[model samples]
Target: MQPTTRLKKPAGSRNEILTVGAGDRVYESTKLGAVFDMLINHGVPADVVLRDVNIPHQEVHSPQTRISLTQLMTICQNALRLSTDRHLAYRIGASVHVSTYGMFGYAILCCPDFRKAMDFAMRYHALAAPLATIEFSEDKADARWTIEPNLHAVAESALYRFVTEMQIGIHISLMRDIMGPTFTPSEIGLAYPQASDFGLPQDQIGCPVRFEQPANQIVFRSQWLDRSADLGNKTTYPTIVALCDDLLGDLKLRIGIAGKIRAVLLRDIANPPSFEAIAKLLDVNDRSLRRQLRQQGFSFRGLRDELRTQIALKYLRHTTLANEDIALALGFSDAANFRRAFHRWTNKAPSDIRGE
Candidate 1:
């Protein structure tokens, strides 16, 4: 028999995504068009896949349209429900290429090397319109990309798998686009257990896959970062990057004051900027920041607590970091404060939820 340990859920339950930027609706709609079209190709009626998604196929054609992550999650849910292909997320992702990303793709094409491309993508990933939140990191031997759907009130392992696989598929497709068709990640990690129902992702991923891992990550060699891109252009790269930066700025504006604040806070969540300092950095007066947050039915403290709660949970559930270290990561002065804060945010003791 398998051994099991006590695993207490987070505030909304462990299954909920509960990301930092909780209420942003900045995702591009065109991405979902692919999912919609895929369903259609699978003999699923257009209306059937879009039942409660409320997005019209025509609207996605517009370059300016944006949708919420919740909508994307709903579309994936619908797609999974009606389609028999359990690896539908990977299939949808595999179909994506540089051309699918619009200006974001162009910026990547202009990158001089794989390292530059990875940096460029990480810096402007919001433009790529991922179904989940992805963070990039590197160590001595490997470059890694971690995925988190981070959707508010979202649960269901199936939905998580769908979002995670689709994102990985997109990464693989884009890597192949720039690094030649031969490129593939060294390993893939899935947060969920390997169950028979979801189908085998390794078949489509073409890489070693590990399940019940700390995170959903795509890992590749650090040396591959030096590989030259087939389409890299030293001259045009800067110009394209400039345009991409402008596009990113515009997108951030659309993401709103709270969303922007969340992004800034995430940069240094362990020692987040003071609300006043953040206001000044964002070039908005404190009054305006407070008013905007109030209008959105949020307060800075509330947002901070929510972000801290999620980060705290991730640390406890994913890492074996001592409570004091996790406390430091959340900007708590000491472990006792972190303990109290954790109890306040989650209504459960930290030790109760820490993964075995």
Candidate 2:
């Protein structure tokens, strides 16, 4: 794992939905500002989109607030569905100016060179609160970032592609912010097939695009790494990182028992510990823990099952993992038992998901 890499999880409902309220799943992070603005510019109703995602109307309107993956994902779904633009992700993502990213963007702008900017991005990306994991590396010929969006159980999902494309657009836009507007990636590689004429509105971020790649990648020349940034400042860069570090501490602070348990569980989600184990780790008795969850409108079983169902569906939709393998990974007894429980939770056969 790279030093800068991190991933997050989801929650919702009656089956695939988390039993907890949307409030519990949220963290006090920045708003989905630009995405919503772009959606509205396209004539999509912001209220309708928020309603579809089951978020408060005020959440998106506020400059800073709590947001969860369910809220973000559903917002994208509604925005894409309601809008007429086919290349919505590319348009909005590319149009994003680094200044809109707040202090984090400003820090990158202050870096002495592209190399420092890349390193700064690796370490400080959490300040931006990205949903996808951005991995950076370099070979003799090329410097590359292989981006993997979370919730990619089905690589072909519109949600996945939209999120991924948006990331690509941000890279193009932000690199231009640091490296200059004339900078172009050596190439762009996508894990999924091309959707429509992907490069339409060709005046933006024009680069060679390859489809059906093993990973989503943005490749550029290693020579560019040494290129000096236009606004490199020794003073502002460290100050920005220090402020962002403080912000990160605040983000890492766990507020509720549910959130605390979620952090512990996700650490080793593939082989989850028992209720007793979680209880011991939290320095609480089982009865106390149970009471605390009930107060939050959730149960341990519901929380664990919600995470499992979410990941299982991701695997079913995104990967070709055998039923037995996914079951074992989730600590299920067997494929047969896994299938039965999945139906109970989702009211549909597991195969039914893959079929769709």
Best by lDDT: 1
Which tens-of-lDDT digit does each residue in 146-264 have in candidate 2?
Answer: 88876432344777887888778888888877887788888889888877633323456576788899999999999888776669998888787777665543444333677788788
Q: Score candidate 2 by lDDT.
A: 0.71
Model 1 agreement with the true structure over 280-344: per-residue lDDT tens digits: 99999999999987755468998888778878888899988999999888888999999999999
Give per-model TM-scores: 0.65, 0.64
| Model 1 TM-score (2 dp) | 0.65
Q: Indicate the residue-level lDDT of 65 in model 1.
A: 72
Q: For model 2, state the Cα shift of residue 296 in Å.
A: 20
- How much RMSD separates candidate 2 from the native structure? 18.1
Candidate 1 runs further than 4 Å off: 1-25, 257-356
